[model samples]
Target: MLRQGVSTRPARAGQACRGRPVPFSGSRLRSSTACGAAEVAEAPAAAPAAPQGLGDLPNVVSVLRARGLVQEITAAEELEAAAGAGRLSVYCGFDPTADSLHLGNLLGIVVLAWFQRCGHEPVALLGGATGRVGDPSGRSTERPVLSEEQIEGNVSAIGALLRSVLLRNSPPGAPPVRVLNNLDWFGPMSFLAFLREVGKFARVGTMMAKDSVRTRMESEQGISFTEFTYQLLQGYDFVHLCREHGVRVQIGGSDQWGNITAGTDLIRRLLGGEGKEPPACYGLTFPLLVDSEGRKFGKSVGGAIWLSAERLSPYKFYQYLFQVTDADVIKLLKMLTFLPLSEVDALQAAMGQPGYVPNTAQRRLAEEVTRFVHGEEGLAQAIKATEALKPGAATQLDAATLETVAGDAPSAALPRAAVEGALLADVMATVKLQPSKSAARKLIKGGGVYLNNAKVGEELYKLAPADLIDGRMLLLAAGKKNKMLIRIQD
Candidate 1:
């Protein structure tokens, strides 16, 4: 998620306060120790601002501060009230459209973890039925409807990943999180019963008023009835959570404001019965993360960077974070990391300075995040693969590490008959490289083509079976960066 806003510098450190303590709070405490007869004031106390309740939350505090939603009562008041109420239930729905959750959904996952930290029970809502319908939060077009088996498979896969990630970060002695499939409830629900019970509280007028719906209204490709009913399903999710699980707050990206508020409204109507506090439900939405270029995160020239190792390798995941621009690193560190503000400020300051490089910061962010989502082993493998990117570097990587780096690269074998007298272009093209003979010729001419780890100088360079590094594999490189492996067989 890309957060908005960036001011170059906001005055120098110690410019205002020389003797006075700087107001820094949260995880920014300075520790001191008294050694026998020698007392030391470890580090100067950066007089922390008043400790906010949610500020104690690991990453949610960062999200709230970064999104500027900390001041919103509907957001904070609800969080505070939930904690105060002692195990007030809260939830954020997860639609299992894919095998694994991606970096795009990290914020929501972080929110669930934060909710749990604040001493509230978090219900992980796996959208078994709704995944079939698709939530139109950021989608430009309607997602393809999945078959029951496919949805179920995705739901199971995603549920396992979610449980693994959330459980790893579960605060010590915090409320144990619960994972619930909405399909469990919605599966047996009949259309008539749904309309009478859940659908009755949701109004068409309110649904149409949603920004997601409104955006599609003026377009030639209008919103579908299936998508429009998304709000109703989401609202019903909250209602079910409240009725069944005692969930009262719905947190999501700002785009979910409509659906979240709709759920709150439904809870008020159905459960409140004439507006007597209405279970004190609340809706909190974080700003959708976007970069300075205005492009969304977790997407690139490569496809969506997913969290699942099967869908996206931890190496690739680390690479994705490693590629964060200096412009986005500070914002990313603040949003994605549990690092202290002083440490974050130091990183930001390092990035802003002339000689200080951002690569170290990038690596730190990547390692911390990869370790958080994946295990230490995943981080280690990614580190090895990262080291492998260097010239003349070869590391013994595990199968997962190799697969992560080789992502979609094709593994093809050219027989002896095919390898003899083959044009480098033709050989490379067989593996879907260059796309066309003309493109291949252009790359060869521009010195962007290489074979057997060496540049292809001649246009008609022969790709003989002898060029194979192993019994069949030949290392190919296009330019100094792109690499591919080709094989020859009997």
Candidate 2:
């Protein structure tokens, strides 16, 4: 027989609502609230009543499925009915395996936002404890364990990022998002206590049957006992959240299906007694972000597309989305952004029309996603850098703009004498933009060399003091794609 928590049907049906859904016009949810320690307090003692215009908001499950966000949900009918009935506390856990979250981690946060928009509560859980054990859901080899100190640092950084992003995206008067660390509970409990309380309920046969566990055991680098016990740790997280904070739904990527079911099953075994009713906890998942070739998305030749501006600049993030293929843009627009379905459909339709400009949809996707992740100021910075760096574009290449684009391009320092009154070909050869002066002359003659975004047509063109932007730096482009920055040094 199927497990208590496993569902045979997909949650793709768009359940009807009383009225039209709320379109997430960015202005409605943009707030300047400070996300600090004070806001991370326990969820309010009583669940807040659904906002006054509840009828006007569509069921959150329907909204998610419409946007291609739902993969599989346990007890789909019951979960949908519960969502339509009243406010639900939905959560998604993020393990602090890295210092910053990347594009692959964005869907969970976006799902949380949708729940919040529909007037439900959203909880962001940081897996401070689980990071030490490591999840083996999608891996063939065991993960290298991190030290407690490293885990703690990662937890704090990821917690702050979640708080800021969630708070900024919350609608006005929305309940504040609760940022939690599982270590808070796991730290105090002794291993013996854990074995008695949690381990007793999990059957070895059942655990072995899990896809995550089965696949690893059959591989050459077999799973470790530490990794094998990860599901139990994650399961207990759901139980604690449900009992303490009234959280009822757990959301994650599709790879988490085994772990998520473990939570639901654990809840049923531990909390559902013969004389009592079944616990209302459930699990949901979204498809992993990947490209047409089945390789993971959110990665570039450089590295992961990070959500933190410190790790990857907003300009680079925006550029990555702006370069997405037409085949993927429409799906991403629906899944990633809060743009209305009708609007997304219009963009898709425009792509087939004769007057449609290429990359128009991509630009919109880039702008909306950048605004969500980095906010208005960051979006502006990205757009400015994009404009300033375009070869032969009219936007002035000033020092500030070049500084912003410098993070994504190769750069070097040149002596003032090397640039001032020097032949352009010689400078290009010096910077390795061309293999030799002869090659540089050939490229310049082909009108493929640009100095400060202006095309340099003459093979013998010489650099002037005026050629340097603000007499400090100059942007050099070998073509539309390859660019470098040269800073003048005395």
Candidate 3:
């Protein structure tokens, strides 16, 4: 089943720095080494001032509204006043259906980062308990249940990813982010006690009216009792956080409006008391990340645009942003990057001006976002790999660089004997670069074939030991776009 809102699929641990805390300033990002622990550094001596026009917005809510990050918010004025008055602890939930989060889940992290930048405590709640029941918000069928082992493993991996991304680059004196598992609270609760303390407050008629429940009930597949009660489980999470952790705000995607409100309502009923004042809790939602064509933003032809470098390399991730349409790039820069709105406006204005270079905005968007997700070192590697792998570019190709590029490209492995002195056409066909040997030769004769980004003029050329970069890998290109990496084994 397709998990929506807070739920994410399992992802493996990628090449992310483990255990080390990297400092983040609101105005600028720091660099981190690839795969190794990054050293903690002092905040910059003179950080850039807040972007122009941000001065007019007094609180994080206004900042979010200005950046198109706010879709729906509860008690906007009161929340604004509270945020401006003092730091409020805010939380967003993530269900560990997968090991790594994809592009779809990014806005939540971005929103949390915005809160951090605005001087509020950000809490990331892992749905270790909720993942079992699954969120029914965007589903048409019941979710396949995961074993406890799968759930626990996912929680650990996602928690690591969360810490790596969220804890890094925090503003000075910002509260360190707290990653909590719902299971910590839910695991020990008795079923009868839950029904008495939490379930009693939820009205079944009101619950059935939720879009998630209503939609499922209308479907031929229909909703199950377990899935129907998911909102109550989620709503109680907010109550638990509020009473125990001082968390006062909950945020999520627009699809999660019901779940978010459920939590708010639960807080009001269970904790607000019979007083004239409003409950000290709120819910906010952001528009789902999508393109001009209305297609979801994070998916590619290959698969979900994963946040983990192990699932997808920084180069591939960078390329994805670099290729976004002109229609979408500017908006993305505003929503995804911490770049000043003034700079974003400048980029948007440049898009229609004369003498404008193609993809300048896209390149900047790619670099900024790559750095945010992968760090400075990851961005540098992406750039170097991008430049080195450009078709027919003069940059030298080395085995290390080619291996980085190979992470996102089609590749095959063959014995060193099979590749040495082998006919180029046969090798190309062997790697499935072409439909067959005849097709490979035909492409070669037409001057569309390349070896390590160089044009190949001979249809009968043979692979040589020297052709292998660092004596291990070779890059073959069928024209500019279709490329393959062949690794030789002894």
Candidate 4:
């Protein structure tokens, strides 16, 4: 996920507060313990950031623990014991806030995937029922409720996107991920019946103590009864999964700790009674994925960096991963990829040392993650699209790939004659890359305007018949990142 307004000097990746450079001798990132890095001080006091040099580990929990993925876990010993016993069914729920999951949900997905790789059953629960009544854990205000038709549509689309990525990462013969819509169970029950059976176990005192509830309660926009009962609904979902499918563990983001615990508690109360004991159940959460500035990653001006290629093109998705800050790249690798931690440590070392090639690890992070989510073919498309925009790509890029990569910037359609005989400035203005012809000429003289991926060297440079790339198209770029595809009609 791309943080919208972060500025980090890559040259200072390994600098102490005193500005002295530290040699990467295969150890901690900082040389002097005296200067606690901004990364250390900036992280939340409750959840400490993962330490450097996180090599591969013995078990899933240990790997997550080393990678700093585990922020809060209920009954650590029992969770480990259950997982070690073999074939633990672990799940994480994704509420279809939109038709696609974003970088915000990547941590939970990756955690479930790691368990699946180690032979545990992964149950990806899509919240078809809960989406209609939004979860308020991270929101400052109440969410806009959608129609059942809209939520149901989002559920199926999100389910397909989720399954594509999770199953691609699964071993050939491994148990295919068990996907369930929460509405399957909740749909059949009456409101009164639900209250009598499931809602009865939820105590008011325990509910109010939840930070999400307490904060919303004290706010000017008091939470609605529908939203207040959300946790109860979620709690029963856990109990339902546990009883039917033998799924005893639930994992989610740190903000979901309250709801996750609610589920765990419900599991015990419903099953355990006089002369009977409850089964072992647990909840685990991953820390917030934040940059050094403490702003959540995966958000740009346009919105979230989405998991679905249709929502956010794979080319743009790869670029987002490619732009991750040097400071966060290694940690992101551990969080997002199943790459051996030793390789990540080496990449971490290289990132700290002198003469490190810019974007080497960032590219690897993009490739690994892109391949995992979008598959080999999608990754290839991303790479092809990336290269088609580079310098001297006028005749090199075919028209089809050019159109695909143009998803990055605005595009316009014009007649072939509009580009062939007009001055470069006029064409740039025509495409709205510049406000006026004069402004376009100014940009051209300053060597900021590009036609067909080639920089225009002169203010008066006129577009010629030859400028139509591959005899029929033109790609205009204002700078390195902003590209506009000029579709030329015959």
The candidate maximizing TM-score is 2
TM accuracy, model 4 = 0.80
- TM-score result, candidate 3: 0.81
Ranking by TM-score: 2, 3, 4, 1
lDDT tens digits, residues 1-490, model 4? 0011011222232232332233324422111113322111011234322222112214678778888899988988777755655556688998877889998788888999887666566788888777767898977799997876677778888888877888777765454576777765565455676777888888999999999999999999989898898999899888877765567789999999999999999988997888787767889999988887888988988889998988888888899999998888888998889898999999988987999999999999999999988999889888888887765554466676776676665778888778777888898887788899999888888988877677789889977878776776788878766778887888
lDDT of 2 by residue, 452-487 (tens): 878889999999999989999988889877888999
C-alpha-based local distance difference test score of model 2: 0.83
User: Candidate 1 has what TM-score?
Assistant: 0.72
Candidates 2 and 3 compared: the better one by TM-score is 2
Off by over 4 Å in 1: 1-63, 66-75, 274-277, 394-401, 407-490
Distance from true location, Cα of 409 in model 4, Å: 4.2
Worst 10 residues of 4 by lDDT: 1-10
Rank candidates by lDDT, best first. 2, 3, 4, 1
lDDT of 3 by residue, 75-137 (tens): 889888777766666999999888889988989999998987786768888898788789999
What would the TM-scores of all predictions be? 0.72, 0.84, 0.81, 0.80
lDDT (0 to 1) per candidate:
0.68, 0.83, 0.81, 0.77
Tens-place lDDT digits, model 1, residues 1-490? 0000001111221131222222233322121111111111111123332123334444443445653433233656445544543445567888978888888788777767666665555667788778878888767788888877777788888888887887777656565567777765555556676777767777888788888888877678888988989988898888766654456678887778888888888888887775465666777777666777988888878689899988878888998999888888777776676666678888877876899864978888898889888978889888887764444344543434434566544456668677677888887777777788677878998888866446677777776646655545565666655777555668
RMSD of each: 15.7, 10.1, 10.3, 17.0
Candidate 4 Cα outliers beyond 4 Å, as residue runs: 1-58, 393-395, 407-412, 420-472, 476-484
Better of 2 and 4 by TM-score: 2
